[model samples]
Target: MAADLERQVAHWLAAARTFRDAEEFASLEAWRAVERDVGAPLRRQLNTVVEELIALGDATAKLIATARYDAAALSQAAAAVQRFRRRYFQVDVTLDFIGDAVNTRTSPVLRAALTTLDRLAVASMVSVLQKANKPVPRVLVYQDKGTGASILRAGVRLWAPGAVMPCAAIKIVRHNLYRPTSLFHETGHQVAHLTGWNPSVGAALAQALGHDEELRAMWTPWASEIAADVYAFLHSGYASVAALYDVVGDAETILHWPIGDPHPIGWLRTALGCAFARRCFSEEGPWVALQRSMETRFPISAADTTLQPLLVRSMAAMPRIAEACLSAGVPALNGRPMTDVLEPARVSPAALSELERTVGAALWTSPHWRETEGIRIVALAGLREAEHPETASVWINRARAWLTSEARAA
Candidate 1:
């Protein structure tokens, strides 16, 4: 029995030692210093993870030191150490995923554009949810080096003291500012996950779907994706829709999918976004054209026949689903919908048009034409200049400068 106890204590010590080494490697002192400045919330959370590992190690060491070691006690200590090690490893993986949060490979214009987008996306949510005493979630954008479609990831499962540390990973097609609008869509994912909107939306959607179990099951998987789409629509309007088309517009890829896929068929998703725009803005020209463009571009025949009925059912329920989601969502204004919060008076068409005319006439104008303009409006202005790359670049540059300047001036 005594020999067995010794063996168990050695096992516990080994596990604890492994955790301590991984903890040190994961949160190196020098790297933590730089990350501390990048994100205090994440830094604090990382520190806590490290401390937990240390405490577990110390406790196990003391257990091994005592001349008396019971089998049950040793077993419990070993189990505790293994459990904490698994959690510590998860935190470590997240830290590695986030890395240094700096990229020198991107150009000034593209880097600035990314930084501007990140701020705007965060501010959009903060403007709404902060009033309800929710901390503004922090998102970090990284230029992805891997192949395949651009991806957005978040550590929604990361354990932390208060609220799972909301960290977003947005991998962009590096140096491609034209597609920056996707950032809003990706950031929307973070918002949906952190705000607990998916389950709320699922319950509300289930209620909306009524006795249709098939459609409900189909739509539940898509709750978060739809929430993100609606969020993008409320924030950037046409820019996001246009960006969506650019990314998944191909017929073959956009057409259909298995039930496990998180996003609905691309055509359906695009139509839903257009429907949201029409309902909210009531604008006739580009918004109407966008819906027509998506439908004409990706015909319904491209959608998988097996999933078509479910997709149709989901599309039918989307308007009310969107309305319900927004109604019960974090009110960014005086209980007004997030659309109102994102597209207020300052970013009204008249404001954007007025700024465009003035800024267009003189390229070197004060550049603060729409100092109070929301990032969405500025992004729209940038989109409007798409015909002229130089002008578009100027708008992007001004947007970066404008956004950063305001952030500092605040």
Candidate 2:
């Protein structure tokens, strides 16, 4: 089932990249024309798969919601809910350029594209979960400002009505004036929570580090974000990485840290993402081999190597941190083992190779590459190397060249 979900995710990512690349040289009309040429067959396939999954997800959710509770039943149902949430409620994303400037308010085409993308993302997520034999969630995607906050509010409201556990809602905000990848990164957080991959390590780490502001700030820090990146890497592969880069890296600036939040620094996030991917695929998989090739092609800096120590330290302290949080009465930090939710699955070398190839191709062809921020490129380069060291050196060289050229132009 896990293999199936991974493969399906790979397929959707490939198709998405192809569409994105095709659109680069084509206008809106041209892209639409191509979709017309191909959309029918694709849509038919997509619709059929999606509808069946939706029904399955709905049924599963109902059974769990109403079932009599025994310890075994409760455990099964909890696990089922976790799986269903991932299958039914994961977000599918597409980015459209509104104009020379990203003007969400004024861009009719962008708005329309966002709406279509949201619907497709929802459908695809639902179908993939069902394919994996998991139940689905009731999902809603918001396109306006404050989508995340609003969705949380709606979830609270639904809880009031005693609707099946408050459904997960995601907001797919446009990257009009800011980096779109940041939004995706946040979405990754939402996905991690729903999918049950987010490590229950933050609170543990915070407690271990002591309860100062720094520790409090670190409480729900990059562990969740990093987990999401790893999930995105495994689930969506390179296109997911590319999408992240596109949204976070700006063509005009060296780096534009997100304006308002205290999220971990972006470059670090990217680096950790790549590292996690490498660790996941380093074994005997073709995907691992390909990732090895990519990594070797793209080497990162020595200074950045420091992240490994931090990650290790955090990982080691996680259980202790969770224990501390539990003792301290922080409900959010109470431990819930992710392994209970996500069944273990292996990615064959072939699968790893396929993912690397697809992601490499996507990175080369992504429209946002030229415009992406330098730090992000560097971080991704590191991640790619960590995942596929064979390819890292070459990829990093290419990245460095791009960075140099951009710097020279600036």
Candidate 3:
């Protein structure tokens, strides 16, 4: 039994050393070429967690080696090694996701387009943070199939204790890749986090609801998602709303709002988006058509008894919520209404049309135009596709050309 205990300790001692080798096994050099802003911060976070884990392995090896222990003591040492092993796997899973993000350049088709898309996010963030004079963190766009699009925002706690994410790792779906207003929506989440925009919008929505306790409670929690939606709207205008409507699917999806979900039900959500567009642009084409499509596809009169009233009341109050969201004072914007800063008018259909005409051939070809107007051009393409479904391929190819140019310049 004494010899068996010694052998067991030796086994774990080797296991612990093997754990330390995980840091080098991945050969993180592939990530070395990531933009310095992205690479530097990511390396710091990764190093902090990895070094601490490596140090633990060293300590664990020392503990098991230096002691001659009873069976109970040996069990404890083995358990310590097991715990370290578990923690290592957690970091490993995180690195896999990060690897997925940074290794996107592996494929030629995705490399340029996604790279330029990453730059678009960085540029948009810079525009947002300029007023506050905060440094813009880098963005990494990776492809994944999941609920619409999502972001793992910078500064959020990650797998390892005390490890904060260093950049916005945005997941972009393949179908929406060419017409990705949802990119703006995910980036909007990071913007809201950085600017502290969510709670402020929640408070304003709550106050605007006045005496309606249930409605106030319902909408207040939705502020983060709502703020992101409006942020997407500001940058992409009706394109965001149209993309949202398309993604929400048919009657069943539009009518269904899962409990405890932070998103407004599609019923209220579509209405709110269209309302915001009308508020900003003062008239609506695609927004109104989308609202009608959502409404008539699944009429509320036919909805379940419980869902109908929530829909009606929320719809009635949506314009007010929309008004408050865009109109309310925001300290983050130095008390300017969001419209003043984000300038929703810039992406409005009329403005986009004029931009399309003015930029003409340069819109697709000019590097200067790509840098300045790439985000808007994407919105224009998406909005046009929504309006004239026939033009989808033309616009997609054009956007792809623009993105390819951006990558070549880089």
Give all TM-scores, in the order shown: 0.68, 0.35, 0.90
**Candidate 3 or 2, higher TM-score:** 3
Task: Give the alpha carbon lDDT tens digit for every residue of 178-236 in model 2.
Answer: 21223333344544454444444455445567734543454455456545444344333
Local accuracy of candidate 3 as per-residue lDDT tens digits, 1-410: 34443465455445434533423433344454366777778777776777777676666655566445545566666676677677677776666677667765655556777877888888777777888666687898877776489999988888877778988899888788888888888888988887778888898999989779888887888898988898889989988888888777666677876889999877777788899999899765778887887777778886778878877888887778899988755566786666777888899899999998987887888878878898898889888888887877787887777766645565
- Cα error, residue 197 of model 3, in Å, equals 1.3
Q: Against the true structure, candidate 1 has what lDDT?
A: 0.56
What TM-score, to 2 decimals, does candidate 3 have?
0.90
Instruction: List the candidate numbers ranked by lDDT, top first.
Output: 3, 1, 2
* Model 1 clash tally, residue pairs: 1
How do all the candidates rank in terms of TM-score, highest first? 3, 1, 2
1 or 3: which has the higher TM-score?
3
> By lDDT, is 1 or 3 better?
3
The lDDT per prediction is 0.56, 0.39, 0.77
> Which has the higher lDDT value, candidate number 1 or candidate number 2?
1
